[model samples]
Target: MRVISGTARGKRLQAPRGTDTRPITDMIKEALFNVLGSGIGGASLLDLFAGSGSVGIEALSRGARQVVFIDNSHNAVRVIRDNLNNCGFTQGFELYRNDVFRAVEILARRKTKFDYIYADPPFTVEAIFGPLLETLDRTSLLAPDGSLIIRSPRRMILPLKLKSLQEYRVNNYGESTLHYYRLI
Candidate 1:
């Protein structure tokens, strides 16, 4: 994987060996950033099920102020760390090797807020979204106007409205789907 734009544009990133982690494709990443526009600069972001940290790294490369990456796999964590170091983003970010739900709870308890939140859990994990949305709804982890982007399989249908969040758009990229939600 590689960073698509900004300060660290074109820097190659390493992914964890095997099929355990799936990195976002360049085309989709570019399109996502295009939709994000100028909102990325100076924004704080959270990446859950971060995998190789490609998405968060891309955010940092595009001038985001800070990004928090969370993933439970040891290999994924190692790969993310190496990728961050290689991109010269040794600071301005935090990496957590823990369950995504647990990390989200801790961040919520700490009253952390992010301008953008991205979650790309394995497509087969069907039960995480509801609780995640509920937790986010009850906490201050999402800025009032911030957005949450979810990547899931095209076949699965996600909710359009969840308490404080409302679905704004859905984009299909091959077998994957991107769900864009914003706080009400």
Candidate 2:
């Protein structure tokens, strides 16, 4: 995988092998950042279920002030670390190897408030995502007026509405659907 734009444009990043990890295509990544525009600049991003740290690193490349990446797989964590180190991005990133659910719970407990929360859990695990993320909103884990961007396969059944938030846009690139949820 590679960073699609910004400071680290075209920089290569490793993706975990096997059938588990699916890196976002460069086209989709570019489109996502374009839609995000300058919103990424100086924003705090939390990449939950960070498979390859692709999205979070892209956010940083586009000038996001900081990013927190979470992934449970040892391979994913190692790749993220290597990618960050290669990009000289140590100062503004925190890589944590933890279960996505557990990390969410802990972050909520700690009152983490990020400007953007990107959730891209494995598509097959769709059933539990909505309720779990709704719980995050209920606990005020997301910052006021912040955005939650979710990438899921088109077949995944997820919520269209979340408290204080609304699904405003969806950009489809073949089998993947990138949903942009904003504060209402």
Top candidate on TM-score is 1
lDDT of each structure?
0.90, 0.84
Query: Where is model 2 more than 4 Å wrong at Cα?
Result: none
User: Candidate 2 residues 1-184, lDDT tens each?
Assistant: 7888888888998888887888888888889888878989999999988888999999998899989999999999998998898877878988999987788888888988998888887877777578666865676656777888888888765667777777888888899998877776
TM-score of each model, paired residue for residue: 0.96, 0.93
Q: Ten residues in a row with the worst lDDT in model 1?
A: 131-140
Superpose all Cα atoms of candidate 1 onto the true structure and report the RMSD in Å to 1 decimal: 1.1
Model 2 C-alpha RMSD vs. true structure (Å) is: 1.4
Deviation (Å) of 95 in candidate 2 = 0.8
Q: Per-residue CA lDDT of candidate 1, range 64-176, in tens? A: 99999999999999999999989999788999999988898899888899999999988666787677767766775889889899998888888898778889999999998
Cα lDDT, model 1, residue 48: 92
Pairs that clash in candidate 1: none
